[model samples]
Target: MALAFDEYGRPFIILKEQERKSRLRGLDAQKANIAAGRAVARILRTSLGPKGMDKMLQSPDGDVIISTFSFFLSFSLANDGATILEQMDVDNQIAKLMVELSRSQDYEIGDGTTGVVVMAGSLLEQAEKLLERGIHPLRVAEGYEVASRIAFDHLEKISQKFEFGPDNIEPLVQTCMTTLSSKIVNRCKRALAEIAVKAVLAVADLERKDVNLDLIKVEGKVGGKLEDTELIYGIAVDKDMSHPQMPKRIEDAKIAILTCPFEPPKPKTKHKVDIDTVEKFQTLREQERKYFDDMVQKCKDVGATLVICQWGFDDEANHLLMHRNLPAVRWVGGVELELIAIATGGRIVPRFQELSPEKLGKAGIVREKSFGTTKDRMLYIEQCANSRAVTIFIRGGNKMMIEETKRSLHDALCVARNLIRNNSIVYGGGSAEISCSVAVEAAADRHPGVEQYAIRSFAEALDAIPLALAENSGLPPIDTLTAVKAQQIKENNPFCGIDCNDVGTNDMKEQNVFETLIGKQQQILLATQVVKMILKIDDVISPSEY
Candidate 1:
């Protein structure tokens, strides 16, 4: 009935019940989009500084996420659709933008998701005020571009280069502590920082000037206190032995990494042979058992006390291994196998025929430890040869605490890794922001056009970071910002950032607060670019209705 015949016998279709809706090209669109961006920024602002608060988000199905991540806040609040296929409202569009911004920020740099978002939101908020005062959007964009160059130059000028070694890790450790201050693990920051520094240094590739984070595994268990966490010098396999009679612990173990399975090989084509006599059947069964026994004998001939296989082991092979007093761990994942190969200075043999005495790995000891009331066990392969791979065992009182601790530890570890890669740092607690703001304002004064207003707006946006810090620390934001500016102007100390300590004064360097300059620089660049893009947008189009 939706199709009808025309005069020339041609068919045409009509959508009888359709209705179109559209909104485009006006101040209303700008207002809605800016409002959404501001709303998202407001959510992340309270979680900015060391004294920031956490967000407890509960999903519709009762799942809860306790985090301070800006992307998580944006996802839970603005774009709360059931699925990605749903149409986005104008506000949801802005939320999606922030979500993508934070995702990209996290992937590119491990920290500063909240800081960048809050900064971008502040810029857009300032741009809104300029637009209401009749400043052209293009002029504002031009001004932002100029100010960004000055800010970046100031950043490089202020950053101090660092070195990483046993005696030189104090600065890196302090940076990790600053990164962890806002997280839930601040109570154990000192210990956690030590662990992070050691873990990164252990895996650092001196020639490449990089650390392979994959080599450092983070394993979590819920039972003990958070301070009980320890680092394993080698990889930990989540599985135990393949047979009950196998030795539970093997000291001075020679291990084998096998990618091939233990079961008998299959014929490419389907074929069968029937034996009428019982003696013939018994002979066939004996041949199968001897085949598995021969495989175990090859492992023994190579002096392998422990066997880790990528594929599942046969029961007959397991029995043969148990008989030979060899402990076999079957069904190990490929990733674990690679880590094991790295840890023990061994190679993964893809075929049974390729395994030799030289192919076997060496470990000081291989043991299994049980945890929890149910007695779940994990294999600890420790004291490996030239082992760059290590494991961090995180323990906590409950599931939520463990999750939060892991997140905090990851942030701290990322900062440690960042320093090892670059080693150049700037003072945190808003020291860099205040100094950059002052420099930007000076640069703005030299500009001769309306762009000067936009450059000044950029300077004010930079000030918002320190103001957010003071507000989150429960200090009077306006008064504290005023005092901080006056101190920087009087003493010419770029290190004059808000101090949340005893007097709630301004001195980041004295407080030992610092962060990697790369993250902060990235935040400024990304936030400014996003704000410029948002400012240039004067129209909204929903093409779905058309």
Candidate 2:
């Protein structure tokens, strides 16, 4: 009370107190959120490739559930712990950022969600050191940015040209295996590559003015005899209906193809269907009917007898085709389609007619002329497509194992597809567009120039693989990042998908610039964000300290 202070001094004291409290609260919440995020990441780190293990979670209600690495990450982040952090008045922005980071990290590495968390944890520890050393957050962030640039440069230097021709695909496959633990990668790569090639061939055949199943042959021995001719034609895109007892043999059929899932449309709302909506629905139904009719016609034109659509037809559509005397079966998903295609000799498309019990026992149909070893079929498939094949198989002894296997398979497929279709430009997982704000932010982080901004703009391009895998693998949006990374390591071999001899050629250089530039941008943005996040954590402290 005896001390007198100037007006400026009084204002300074008040501002200092407010700032100190704000920092304290922010730091406390940030630490908690970061810890939770790191923990979630750690749980799924080992579940990266097809060879990655499964995880089991038991609910409080005595329910035992099993899931893959990606699923686990999603579950953990969306679990009660994350909710508690939010409830504790954790900064929503930071919490949400961590959640997204977790998702992105999981998607980027497939099995490295845990690794990312650990990395983040390490970063946090390092940040603490920086703080102790009295390093300002700004300086730390700047240093990290420099370090990230170096890391990205290293990644680029290490990146080999992605090749896809038959001559060097094995080495490419081996490269993917370098960081993985599963033998399924080679098996799946061969199988899927073969399937894609066969599918392409089948489509090419159908597109031919002359549709002929006679041109296709069943190759291989099952139960000791030469395989019978059961031609599978196009991609089965449908599901089978759950109905009255169909033939046991039909039900027992190991491989059938349909154009759509068999599940009926969900019940509609009680509100009366509008005439316009009804008309549109009716038009779609008519189009579907015509499509099937044309498909049957094509089958007849091609002299195909056993046909399956990966997609499903309506009851009327099914009846119409069945009445037309075409032997057919339908499968619900692409997984089932692949199984059917493999059973039918590599043909992704099914021929006309339902498969008889006797025919089902024989190799259902042969998509390609190759047989025996999976490698041979894969080679044949690749040759047919003029592209390369890479498969990632997940093997486990339990349900968790199977789930993880499927997730790995889906990721590998996406990587391979991107390499083949888009020349290996890294796109967002699931077609998510990078927001304009994010792009701007990313550009600003680079040199303050338009060229750098344009170069960084590619970061906004959405990658469809992760999203597709997440949707297909049953993981939520939160877990996609982990799954993506796992898959990337398993499938990313620049030299794997490209023709090695063609390297340094003008054509190669052009393709390289186009492909690698986008990849570089993606790498840059990811690295930058990671470093920025680390810097932001410098001020964080344990809640217990408060």
Steric clashes per prediction = 0, 96
Model 1, 401-469: lDDT tens digits are 676677677777888888877888999878899999999999987999999999899999998889999
**Ten residues in a row with the worst lDDT in model 1?**
77-86
lDDT of each: 0.80, 0.37
Model 2 TM-score, 2 decimals: 0.43
TM-score for every candidate vs. truth?
0.90, 0.43
Off by over 4 Å in 2: 1-23, 26-56, 65-96, 105-114, 162-164, 182-324, 328-401, 415-528, 537-546
lDDT of 1 at 467: 94
Over 4 Å off, model 1: 1-21, 63-91, 503-505
RMSD of each: 5.0, 16.4
